[model samples]
Target chain A: MSNQSLVDAEWALSHLDDAKVVFIEVDEDTEAYAGNHIKNAIALNWKTDLQDPIRRDFVNKEQFEALLSAKGVSNDDTVVLYGGNNNWFAAYAFWYFKLYGHSDVRLLDGGRKKWELDGRELVSDVPSRAATKYVAKDQDLSIRSFREDVLKAIGTQNLVDVRSPDEYAGRLLAPAHLPQEAARIGGHIPTAANIPWSKAANEDGSFKSIDELKALYEGAGVDLNKDTIAYCRIGERSAHSWFVLHELLGVKNVSNYDGSWTEYGSLVGVPVAVGDEPGTA
Target chain B: MSGCGAVVGGVSLDNVDITNQAVIQGVISSGNAPASVGYARLLDRNDEFVAEVPISKQGEFRFFTVAGDWTIVALIPGANSRTPVQATIGKILDVDIAVIK
Candidate 1:
C-alpha cells in the first residue's frame, strides 16, 4: 500500500498545533533549529536520533522507539519531515521511518527553503508535549540493502549509483571542498549505472512531477518491475533517489544500499569500476 | 576523538608543527535547536574545499588544521545559508558557530 507522500507549507502551517501531527526538522546541523524553526516543531538530528552511535548504521528498533517516545511522538501521530539541503537528508530520514514501518509519515514539500521563501514564520519558542510510548514495527528489509545484498545483485543492471558525475567517474574523491566526506577510494560498485540524485528534484528543492520522475528513471534504465538498488557516497543522496523511484514513481522493488560507496569503497575485495576510463573494468 | 584528528581517513593527518596545529570544534546551531548530522566545511581563503566533518550527536563538530587564517562554513543538508566565519587556526581553537539556514 502506498503512503501519503508530501505536505505543502500551507498544509503544515494550518496544522501547527494539531495534537496528532508532529513537525520534525531533520537537518544536518542542529544549530539551525535553535535559532528559528517552524512553530511547534521538534528537532531530530539525522545522525544522533537515527544513527547507531556505536556502529555505522541506523539505530535499533528499541532506539527508534525511545527516540520517538522521548520526542512525544506516538505511533498514531503523523510525522512530517523537512530539512535544509534540498531535503536529501530529510528524504533519507523519511526512508528510515519507512523502513521501520511508520506508515503515516510525510515529507514537507519543497522543505524549509520553500517555506521560508514564501515568508512563513519561524519561531524560537520550544514547545513541550506529553511524552507517549512509541511502538516500532519490525524493519522491512526489502527496502534496505547491505553489502552482501549488493554483492548478490552485482552485474544485474539494476544497481544505480546516485552520485554526481565526478563521483561516479572517480574524478574526485568527494566534493573537493568537503574532503572529510570522502571515501577510502574513488569509483562506484561494479555494474551500477550512474543516475545522479539531483536530477529527481526541481531547482526549488522540491521533487519533480511524477511524470518527469518516471521518465527520468526509465530513461536511466531503472526497471520499476525489477529489483533496484541505489547508492551514493554515504547513502543519503541515494535515499533521495530511492524516494523518487519507490515513493514518487511507484517502483515496487527498490532498496537503498545505506552502506553505499563509503562501505563498498573501503572493502578489501569487491569489484569496482571507475566510469571516466571506459572499459577499464 | 571529536576533533579533525579523530575524523581520520581519506587524507593523512600527520606531520604538523605540533605546536602550531589547532582544533576547531563547536555546536552547529540553528537557533536554540542543535543538529547532529550536518557538516562544518573548512575552506581555503580562496573558497576551495579543504575538509569537512559530520556534526556529532551532541551538536558538536570539529576540524584540525595548521596555523592560518581560514574560512569555515556550516552546511546543513537542505539549507543554503553560507554565512562563513573567519577563523584563525593556532594551537587550540574553540569556536561556537552556526549553520546558515
Candidate 2:
C-alpha cells in the first residue's frame, strides 16, 4: 500500500492512536530539540541510538532492541518517526526499523517543523507507563545492509549520492565531513547516480509528491524497479533519501549506506573519486 | 548582538547563523534543577544556557534578551536530551516552547 505523506502535522498526529508512532528529533545540534518537541515524542540521538562507534554498519542487534524497547516500540507497532524540522531523522529511524525487520515504518512528512508549523500542540510529557514487550526474530535481517553487500553492490544496484554536488564534486568539504582516504580508494561506484538531497524537496522541507518523486529519480538515471543505494555525509541524510525512495516513490529494493562516506572513504584500500568531476557515463 | 551560531556538526546550517547566544533559549523538561515559568538564563558564547527557565503551563518562554542571536535549551532529565533540541537563529528568530495545552 502507498504510504500517506506525513506532511500535515495535525493529520499525522490525528492518527497517532491508530499506530505506534514515535516522534524523533535528529539534528546537527540539540539546541532545537530542547526548545520543545512534538508531544509524547521520544528523542533518539543519531550518535547514540542509530550508530555504534564503529560507523557505517548496524550496531549489535540486541543493543538496538533495547533502545527500541525503551522508546515504547514493539514488533506490532507501526512506527512513525520524525526528526529535526522535517522527515530527515524520521527517515533514519525508518531505515533502521526496516533494517531490523520491523515491518511497518514511515516518516512524518515535514517532520516537527511541519507539525509545529501546522500549529499542533506539543508537550514533553512522555508518560506512557506501558512498556510493550518487543521480541526480535533473531534472524530478521530483512532490512539491513552489510559491508559485503555494499562492496558487492558496485555495478549491481545504482548508487545514488544524495549529497550536494560540491560534496559529490569533492569541493567545499570539511576535514571531518568525509573520510580523507576515500578520494584515493574510489570515486562514485561504477554505475552510481547523483541526485542531491534537496532535489527531493520543494525548497521547504516538505517533499515532492510521488509522481514528482518518480520523475525526479527517472530523470537522474535511476530505475525504480532495480536496486538502489542512497547515501549522504553520515547515514542520516541518506536515510531520509531512502525513505523517499521506498515510501514515496514506491521503489522495491533500496538501501542506505550506513557507513556512508565517512566509513567507506576511510577504508585503507578502496577506490576514490577526485574533484567535482563525474566519473563516467 | 551577533548571534552565536553552531561551531560544528552542520553540513549546511541554512547559513542562517543559529548558534549565537542571543538568538536561542530553551528549558529542561525533566530535572531537579528548580526551574520555573518566566525563568530565563543567559547563554554563554558556547551557546549553552547557564541558567534554567521555569516552564509555564502554556510552555511560553521569554528570555529577557530578545531580538538578538540566542537559543533556549531545555534541561531534560536524560543526558542525551540536550543535543537533539532543534535550534535556529536569525535577525528575527524564535525560541521553541513546550507549552502544555
- Whole-model Cα lDDT per candidate? 0.71, 0.53
Calculate the i-RMS of every candidate, to one decimal place.
9.4, 15.4
**What is model 2's C-alpha RMSD?**
11.2
lDDT of 2 by residue, B6-78 (tens): 2222123244333331233333332333233222233433453222223343333333222333334442222
Q: Which stretches of candidate 1 lie over 4 Å from their true place?
A: A1-3, A180-183, A277-281, B1-101
Candidate 2 lDDT tens digits, A39-153: 6666777655666656434566787777777767778776667765245566776677766778766677766644543446666555462566676545344344555666677
Off by over 4 Å in 2: A1-7, A16-22, A26-30, A53-57, A138-143, A174-187, B1-101
Q: Locate the minimum summed-lDDT window of 10 residues in model 2 chain A.
A: A173-182
The TM-scores, one per candidate, come to: 0.73, 0.65
| Candidate 2 lDDT for residue B1 | 10
